[model samples]
Every structure is written in structure tokens, then in C-alpha cells.
Target: MTHILMIPGSLRAASSSRATARALAARLPQGTTCTTADPGVLPHYNADVTDDAEVAAFIEEVRKAHGVIFVTPEYNYSVPGVLKNAIDWASRPAYESVFKGKPCLVVTTSGGALGGVRAQAHLKYILNGMLAVIYPCKEIIVTMANTKVEDGILKDDTVLDFAEEALAGFVATCG
Candidate 1:
């Protein structure tokens, strides 16, 4: 069975990013299980700290997953600091980390028309720098995402359909 680890960039419970992740997880095909990681529980990244249980567990989650899905909202045209901190913690030993060669799919959401496109680009670049194999597909950007969610779940059929297709393709490439 293919197992995917979803990382939502926002810390808010009602955030579009989390809603997107929740929506996508519910649509994953049979035989494919998913788990969402909460980056908020992690501490600030410190190069000297090696005994952080949260950090270690987070890294292990990345290491064990067949692939990773990043659901994020644009923050000043870039990924949020919390998401970046989680990445920094998992990225260890320089070029050889748990993220190295891991399959990754990025989905960006926004309240604006641009749909967090800039943040998507930034995240792809960051993942590339870690030697992660980014899924090669048309970008998944959900515009006006704030209104698409209701009761903590994304309810847009149009966006959900397209995202489900992209996610299926992403799953096909997972190792």
C-alpha cells in the first residue's frame, strides 16, 4: 500500500491549506493510506540539537512515507515560517537527508486570485535543493480558496476534481 504524508503549511485549524489537505485525503484511492503531520508541534530548528523527540519523529515520518504532499498558503509570496522550520529540521547532514530523493507534490491555495503560485514556486525550489524528486505536473493552484472551505473542509467540486487527478498522478510516481 502506498502511504502519503501530508504537510499543511498553516497553523490555523480552519486554514485553507489544512482544509485542502483534509479534502484531498478523503479522496485518496483505495489501498493508499495517508497521514497528516502537524508542524506546529515542532520546535524551532537548531543545528546543535540532536535529541529533540519531535524532530526525530517528524524526520522518521518523512523517511517512511512513500511520498509527501505539501498543502500551503502563500505568506508574503512565500511559504510560511512554520513549514520552513519543519523542513529545516528534517533536512539534516547537508545533502543527505530524509527528504533526499523523496517524491513530493506541491499544492498551493490562496484567498486571492493568484492562488499562492509564488509560494508554489518557492517550495518547489526548496525541495529541489534538498534533492527531493518533485512531481512533474501542471501546477495545482486553488484560487479564492478561503471561500471554498466550509466547516473545516474544502467543498469545491471543481478544485477537488482537478486536485484529485493531480494527486492520483503523484501517487503513481511514488516509490
Candidate 2:
């Protein structure tokens, strides 16, 4: 079974990005278990506390993950600070980090016309520095995401189809 770790770029209770992440998680292939990262409990990246139990546990989860999916939102044409900080925390220990060689999938949602293209670009570059293998397929950009989901479920078939296809391809490559 493929173990996928999903990270959403927002901390809001009604975050559209989180909703989209949950939607994608529901569509992952059978035998795949998708879990979202708990960045709320994570303190900002601090090398001094690198050995903290929470940090260690989170690192362990990333080390065991077969793939990672980032469901992010655009914040001033870049990724939110918290998500970037989380990535930095996970990419420590230089070339021996858990993110090394892990397959990464990036998707973005926003209320803007360009979705989150700029943030996606920044995230791709960061993953490159981490030596992660990122999927080179159609980027998933869900614009005006507030309207795409309702009652905690994706209400758009087109969006769901795209997510399913991307997830299927991701699983095939990583599995």
C-alpha cells in the first residue's frame, strides 16, 4: 500500500485548500492511505529543538511516506509561510532528509484567475533543492475553490476527475 502524506497550506477551519486536500484524499487508489500533516502542533522551525518528540514523530511519518501531496493556496503570489516553514523543518539534515528522493505532488487552489501558479512554482523549486522527485504532469489548479466544494465534499465533477487522474498517476509512479 502506498502511504501518502498530504499537507495543506492553510490553518483556517474553513480553508478551501484543506477541503480540496480532503477531496483528493478520498479519491486515492485502493490500498493507499492518505494522511494530512498536523502543522498546527508543530512549532516554527528551530534547529535547537530538532530532537523534540513532536518533531521526531513528524519526521518519522515523512520518512515512512511513499509520496507527498501539497494542497496549497497562493499568498501574495507565494506559498503561505507556515507551509514553507514546515517544509524547511522536514528538509533538515541536508542530503539525508526524509524528503530526499520522495515523490512529491503539488496542487493549488485560489480565488484568483491564475489559481496559485506562482506558489506552485516556488514549491517546485523548494522540492528541487530537497532532491525530491516531483511529478511532471498537468498541474492541478482549482480556481475559485470556494464554489467547488459544499458541505465538506467536492461538488464539481470536473475537479474531482482531474484530482483522481493526477492521484492515480502519482500512485502508479510512486508505488
Candidate 3:
């Protein structure tokens, strides 16, 4: 069974990005499993503090996963600090990190018209820096995202279909 590590970019209560992430996980194939990681719990990145238990655990999760999906909401046209910090921590040992050779997909959601595409691009660049095998599909952006999620459920079939298609590509990439 394929194991996917999902990392949502926001710490906001009832965040639409988180909801979209949950929906994507549910849309995966039956044999696959999705585990959400809490980037918010990671401390600020520093070379001197890279060996903590939490950091070790995060690295292990990524190492064990078959693929990773970063569900992000744009913050000032780029990734949120929490997500960036986590990436910084994981991107150590210079091309020898767990992210190396792992497939990664970036999905962005936002209330704005751009649907966090800028952030998605930024994340893709970051993933490239780690030598992660980036999924070849185009960016998946959930725009006007507030309308797509309600009560923690992704209610729009159109958006869900789009997400499912994106997941299919990601799954193929993972294989």
C-alpha cells in the first residue's frame, strides 16, 4: 500500500486548505493511506537545533512515506512561515534529506482569484531544491476556497473532481 504524507500549510481553525487536504486524502485509491503532519508544531529552523525529537520524527515520517502532498494557502503571495520552517528543517544534509527522491505534489487553495498559485510555484521550487521527484501535473489550485468547504467538508463536486484528477496524476507519479 502506498503511504502519503500530507502537510497542510495553515494552523488556522477550520482552514479551507486543511479541508481540501482531507478531501484529497479521502479521494485516494482504496489501498493507499494518508497521514497528516503538523508542521505547526515544528520549532523555528536553526542548524544548532536540528536533532530534536520532533525533528527526528518529522524526518522519519517523510522518509517512510511513498509520496508527499503539500496543501498550502498563500500567505502574502508565498508559503506560510510554519510550512517554510518545516521545509527548512527537513532540507538538511545537502541533498541527502528524506525528501530526496520522494514524489511531491503541491496543492494550493485561497479565497482570492489566483488560488494561491504563487505559493504553489514557490513550493515547487523548494521541492526542487531538495531533489524531490515533483509530480508532473500542473498546479492544483482551489480558488474561492471558502465556497468549496463547509463544516469541515468539501461540498463542491466540481472541486472534488478536480482534486481527484490531480491525485490520479500524483499517484501515477508516485508509482
Best by TM-score: 1
Return the TM-score for candidate 2, rounded to 2 decimals. Answer: 0.95
Kindly list the per-residue Cα lDDT of model 1 for residues 1-175, writing each as its tens digit. Answer: 9999999999996799899899999988778999999999999988888899999899999999999999999999999999999999998877899999999999999999999999999999999999999997867888999999899998999888887888889898997
- How would you encode candidate 2's per-residue C-alpha lDDT over 17-132 as one tens digit per residue? 99888888989999999888877667888888746777777788788889999999999989999898888888988877998999999999887778799999999999999999
Instruction: Tell me, by lDDT, which candidate is best.
Output: 1
The TM-score of candidate 1 is 0.98
Per-model root-mean-square deviation over C-alphas: 0.8, 1.1, 1.1
Per-residue error (Å), model 2, residue 153: 2.7
Local error of candidate 3 at residue 38 (angstroms) = 0.1
TM-score of each: 0.98, 0.95, 0.96
Candidate 2: 10-residue stretch with minimal lDDT: 148-157
Tens-digit lDDT track for model 3 on 1-175?
8899999999988899998888888898777888999998888898988468998899889989999999989999999999999998889888998889999998999988889999998999989999999986766888999887878866778877877887877877775
Candidate numbers sorted by TM-score from highest down: 1, 3, 2
Residue 65 in model 1: shift from native, Å? 0.3
Residue pairs clashing in model 1 are: none
The clash tally of candidate 2 reads: 0
